[model samples]
Target chain A: MVDQPLAVAARSLFYRKKRHRDLRQRFIEVLLFLAALSSVLTTIAIMVLLVTESLPLFEKVSIIEFITGRDWAPLFDPPRYGILPLICGTFVTSMVALFVAIPMGTIAAMYLSEFAAPKLREVAKPVLEILAGIPTVVYGYFALLFVTPVLQMLYSPFGEKLSEWLPDIFPYELEGFNMLGPGIVMGIMITPTISSISEDAMRAVPVELREGSYATGATRFQTAWKVVFPAAISGIIASYILGISRAVGETMIVAVAAGLQPTLTLNPLRPAATITTYIVQVSLGDTPHGTIGYQTIFAAGLTLVLLTLFFNVIGYFLSRRFRETY
Target chain B: MQGSLAGVRGNIQRRQLWSAIFAIVGLLVLFIAIIVLLALILQLAIQGVPRLSWAFFTSFPSSKAEEAGILSALVGTALVMLVTAFTAIPIGIASGIYLEEYARKNWIAALIEINVTNLAGVPSIVYGLLAMGLFKSALQLGESVLTAGLTLALLILPVVIVTTREALRAIPSGLREAAYALGASKWQMVWDHILPYASGSILTGIIIGLSRAIGETAPLITIGALTFISFLPPSPFKSDFPFLSFDWVRSPFTVMPIQMFNWVSRPEPEFQLNAAAAGVILVALTLLMNGLAIYLRYRFRKGVKW
Candidate 1:
């Protein structure tokens, strides 16, 4: 009887330990699964709402008209559905931003990574990153107040000289608020993003490469450009593409500095509108939530989302393809 | 042969010159960033320093222009942030802890990791839409500060998880083994030995993530934060408190950005100046939070060892 009681107690203890272990494992698994699920729910719910609202706009306006129309007068009585002007404006502004950001940002990264002393790199890197941490609204104010005035001064004097060279084709009015001003400000805003990521890529290149180049009597500059820079080319390219995406997605600076005209002219000095700016415009209006006018905001959002998604996909694949092979 | 060697040296020198040019260009980029920061700070001080007074922080929004104050918005923002931090940090840190310490090498874990990486890149407006459906439609939380906080929490979960994993990874596995060897259980080893050592890293990451969450305007706007709340909620969870009631949940609440947007969009040039002043305050707050987080991170990295 004593042996039976002892055996029964042992069995109970064994079962309890097994159950506790199983419970702990299950608990952790459940928590992680919930975390992952939260992300999916977020992505799916956004798509659904955007689609539901945008469907009404599609019903009233043809998809072709939305894509190919030259004018955007959504606030006017006869609301036009042409999205081309906004799309062109977005692309031109973003391209200008890219042109300004890439060379400057790449050089900055190179200087910090290859040229600057350790103390300088440490000091400069964080200060540059602090630019990124500044709020977009502040940048918007800077663009509206400072950048516009500076550009206006350049255009006022230069515009007359250029017009004299070609009177027939160049009848220019240098607007203080135009794509040029916003593009310049956007370029500055995106510089930190490009420099930080590119610097990380450059720093990842092994010191052995630098040492080997130097053994052949290569200068510090020579080793950085021919050997180290080429090695990190893919990452550098990826950073620039990421910068392009950011420039395109940027909202506040463009909305504030760029003039609110949806004209489809190719000129950089003209006041232009972007998709994000259009979304802000409609959202701020008195349009009812369920109306077609309101739905256009979702359509604009969908376009922005799709464009960013495409760019991110390309960037993801390229970066993954080169994943720090060192 | 000596002439050819000289030619090769000339080629090398040209390359070096180009490299110097590139380096100068890089320095130019950093210079532009610095110049912009300086210009913004100077502009803000020149314009906003005179206008910033007790009345600006304490008064209520008014159509009469001069009577405007951000008191209610400030309180509302604080309440939303505290609630957001309270709800988000626990779950975010827990999920991070599980993935870093407990999850074994398996497909399930890999799937979770990939999902989280992608989630961090999704747009904030999308998160807003999601909050509208989940909390507003399904859970019936409505468009209150609680819903807004939860939405922002969800938006930043991936960031928190990623940072926490990095922090945990920084801790060597030897410490975990040492805890187990002392006859500590798995949970005890983690809670006692691992968490304390990594607390500084986790706190720094959390503060950084929280700062980002605080400045986010998209998700909050989507969750339907009222653009104007005249009174504070009587209780934290009550429909209304200090100035407004919970009934305002269904109404549009204005945040700093939304308010700034309102002011700037007007044709009145005075509003643009007001926008600049408001922007200075907002920038100051964000920078302070960010600076603190960065300092904490630097301290943690320098002083601590695995």
Candidate 2:
């Protein structure tokens, strides 16, 4: 009878410990789940904040006019809210940036993944990372101070001669704060992003493919371009899309170097304002809590978010879809 | 037969020439990119070196460019980073753990993954806008160090999460199996085995995230950080019983990038020099952090083998 009582007491003690451990485990899991949920909450908060703030602006200005209008002077008398000018500026800068980035990034990826020796690759990778790590504000300074001066010095004389020859086409002089400088700097900034991603994709291509091409007497360049490039095209495309998204959303370079005027022009020689630049311009001023001037930034923000979201979604899918199993 | 042989030789020669040309072209392109980077750093150093003295670091901003300093801005950056490190570390690591260790492979997990990816692509300026509405207006936090820190914390949360998950994922499944074989609970297994192994990598990610946050300008500007703050936030240390105070978090602040932006925007060459000096400091700090992270990662990798 004494042995039975001791056995029962030990069993009860074991059960209690197990229950206690389970409770603690459950509590920790709940805390971790809440931590995970914070990201979703942040996303929801962003959407809600943008939408709610933008709704009142929409009530004041029709969505059609907001989208299709050519004027964007929201602070002037009878404020104009057309976003086309900002969009055009963003388009021009991004186009210029892409023109530089796509070719350079692809070539760099080819060199790094296929051609460079291991030691060279190691050195080159960090160089690219340093380029990537430089702050946009520093780039802004470089764009404004160095690149612009060089462009002006080189292009001014030639531009004057060309404009005299073809008055209708060539600009007389590249302005001090033209889009080209910032665009070029932005291109340099984005090169690492594209090259690194595309390099990863190229490296993922099976070595057998390279060997097969070499066996047929293909050179390294030929093998890389013809075989590996096509195989990694999806990832390369995804990188380009991401680059475009970055260029579209870039702020400090355009804000500091590209002039604040929102002129709806396609010429790279002219200074203009992008969506991001305009937001910074307004924010720098003490525009009060609830005004059309203030609300315009949110509208622009919504447009920016949508534009990047579109490219990001496409990129996300393209990368997932074309990821090679081998 | 002679003619056919000659044609084949020409073809081979042309192909070889093209290959040689491409190899040179690729090398040249890489050289140009590196040259540009070197030129940027060189330009900053040449202009800013003379301006980087003790007085520049210790004094406050002045109407005269020669006398202006970055004391308040540096202090603000430190305080804001303090808040950011505290808030982001625990939450980001916990979320990463949940995703990698606990969550079932279901819709919710997939949604979180996609959301994180999308969040990474959202423009930094948009995050600023979010802070303006949610933090400054809705929550009425004002343009304080606390708000800026939280804003940056959110900005880097995705990066931290991704890196944490990557670190955790790199731990071999054999370890997990061994822990479970020992009758360890899921939390016990993660807390004991997985975390210690992954701590170095997680730390590297945190440092990198902080570096990125430090150089950020657009988001901070959008949240309305001042271009000129002549005063510092309240001391984080108190002479009272508790000995620590958070009043600094709610104080107005400025950061290195903003100060640099302010000086760069000025029309005077003197102000531009100040801007360059600030740029040199900011870039140096960022490079230092990244270097430390790289060293930690290399050391950790060398120590661990599956």
Q: On residues B1-306, what C-alpha lDDT tens digit does candidate 2 reach at each position?
A: 357988878877888888888889889889989999988999999989899999999989988999999999999889889889999999999999999999999999898988888888889999999999988988999999999999999999998999999999999999999999999999999999999999999999999899989999998998899988999888888998799988898999999999999999899999999999999999999888887887888799899888
Q: Which segments of candidate 2 are over 4 A away from where they belong? A: A157-169, A317-325, B1-3
Error of 1 at B173 (Å): 1.5
TM-score of each: 0.89, 0.97
DockQ of 2: 0.80
Instruction: Write down the TM-score for model 1.
Output: 0.89
The best candidate in terms of TM-score: 2
Specify the highest-lDDT model's number: 2
Report the poorest 10 consecutive residues by lDDT, candidate 1 chain A. A280-289
Q: Write the per-residue lDDT of candidate 1 for residues A1-326, one digit (tens) a residue.
A: 76998999999998898789779867766875576556556667677777887898898889999888887886578889899999988998898788878877887888889999899887897787677777666677787778878776665575554455566776776576788778887888788789888888899999999999999988888788888888887788788877877788777777777877787977777888888777655544454456665677778877877888798788878877766566
Worst 10 contiguous positions by lDDT, candidate 2 chain A = A156-165
